[model samples]
Target: MNIVVVGGGLAGAHAVQELREQGYPGDITLLGEERHLPYERPPLSKGLLLGTEEVQSIFVHDQEWYADQQVDLRVGTSVTALDLDRGRVHVGDHPIAYDRLLLATGAEPRRLPILDALEVPVLCLRTLDDATALKSHLAGRVLIVGAGWIGLEVAAAARRAGADVTVLDTAALPLLAVLGVELAALFADLHREHGVDLRLETSVVEADGSTVTLSDGTRLNPDVVVAGIGATPRDTLAARAGLATGNGVLVDARLRTLDPHVYAAGDVANHDHPTLGRLRVEHWDNAIEQGKHAARAMLGDDQPYDRLPYFFTDQYDLGMEYVGHVGPDGYDEVVVRGDRERRILTAFWVRNDRVVAGMHLNDWDAMDSIRQVVGSPRSQAQETTARP
Candidate 1:
């Protein structure tokens, strides 16, 4: 059976790797738009930006590993069109036939219209190239628009580099939608204490070269500008092929799309989770797990994929690991253990008196305990007593 995977990111690479590991001795082809091999993106903003992590360490596998695995890895190739009816994907009129296909197209950064309209080059953090370019722009004064995870991480990295950092966000606090007011306040304080000029409920109204005007009549000339707003799933190929598409390509519990011959994983798959319903995750853990699940599904596995959403971040002295799902207003109350002032604590998001999600800030050994409480279908009162 000939299998074709589109995407060179973590998910696509892992999916193909899983296929070979599972002892699938059929033809396998992996195509990626980028010239580089499949690489992890988290280091791009953290150690890579800070000049601590080497560029070679970011790749998932060495260049020779692909050849050793007998995988036809094609880099710098774009899948221009998907012909689902013919089971072929066209690369600029060159068609490759496949018996089964996986679309791990990942996502692209959401462009900032103000910067685009002003014809100002604003750096974004999504790929390796972006991070390499941003490292050079991390000096002098850096103005960041958006206080999401990416934006805040960039701010932390810039401040550590001794750059005069100013962060503007329309939300009241960073990660307001993910963490409620109480937890969000912690991040706000963290950045402020690090000497970041964080401006909440503010936005860039106008810009003339390096001088930018804010909504509150504040004008400042910054040496560099960065847009770390968010990203949109790259599902245009699936949508054009008449596959079900929403925020991402709609897939069932097994990562199988409506067409039995095709599947999707990673950031591009909006999975119909058994317990959580339809949702799409853009985290590194999700990409790794979902890619393996998709590979098994393509190999005729019947089990469902229902792993909880997990993500982590490292900003200066603060390191965090969060598991499960809870929107800003999704939880009724947040239960805390340990001291928040000392930055060593584990917080649980309770909904209907049950622990739905949990997170730890600077608490290294709390993940196992957080996972136990979050994975169990127990009451919050009972879970609270079971501390790490």
Candidate 2:
């Protein structure tokens, strides 16, 4: 069988590797829009931005490895169209036929609409090129829009690089969606303690050249501006190809799309999560694991992808980890393992006396225990006592 995997991010790279390792002797073609080989993205904001990690070290596999695996790598080529009925993908002037296809397009960074209006140079941290540019332009004051994980990470990197850093967010507390109010407040304080100028409940009305005007009419001159709001999945290609699309390319428990021959995985897939029901994860671990599972399913394995989703972020000395799913609403109680002031906190969202979701900050032990509890069906009391 011939397999074609599009978008050479972590998911695409992992899928191709898994397929070859599983003894798939068929022709495998990995198409990537980026000129660089597949590389890890998690380091873009943390290590690379801070100059602790080299760009060449990010690739999970080297060029020699791909050749050894007998996988054809097509770099710097964009898949413009998908001919579902014809079983072919169009890349510029070339069209490649495939017996099966994997969509691992990943996600693109979200940009502010008025990004051009900001007279000062602005940067994003989605790609290696973006990180390189931002790193080189860190000699002056930097202002970041949004206090999410990426924004905070960039802020940390800039501060370490001796640049005056400021972060602004419209929400009353940054990280509200992930950590909730109580924990988010603690994170806000963490930034302030590190000498970061953080403005909460503040909206950017206009940005021009060297100044950003806030809704409160406060103007600040900055040399660089960064918008790390978040990302949206690249689902248009799959949707246009007539596959089910909702939030992301919809898939079943087996990671198979409506069309059995086509599969979607990684950040671009909205699969039926085992414990959480249906959800889409943008986590780095989820992308690698899910991509491997999808490749297994393509090899005719009856196994269903049901791994517990996990994600972690590094900000200064803090290591934040999150596991499981907690809806925006519906939580009866919150269990805190350590006080926020101590700089070690783990909060569990308890519903119906069961730990539904959790977040950890510097609480490594709690993070390990929570990961196990989230995977198993157990009451909060039992899980709490089981933890040492």
Considering every candidate listed, which one attains the maximal TM-score? 1
Candidate 1: stretches off by over 4 Å? 117-120, 327-329, 375-388
Model 1, global lDDT: 0.90
| TM-score of every candidate | 0.97, 0.95
Q: lDDT winner among the candidates? A: 1
Q: Which residue pairs in model 2 clash with each other?
A: 119-208, 119-209, 120-209
Residue range 225-298, candidate 2, lDDT tens digits: 89899989999999888999988999999999999899999999999876678888888999999889989999
Error of 2 at 121 (Å): 1.6
CA lDDT for candidate 2: 0.85
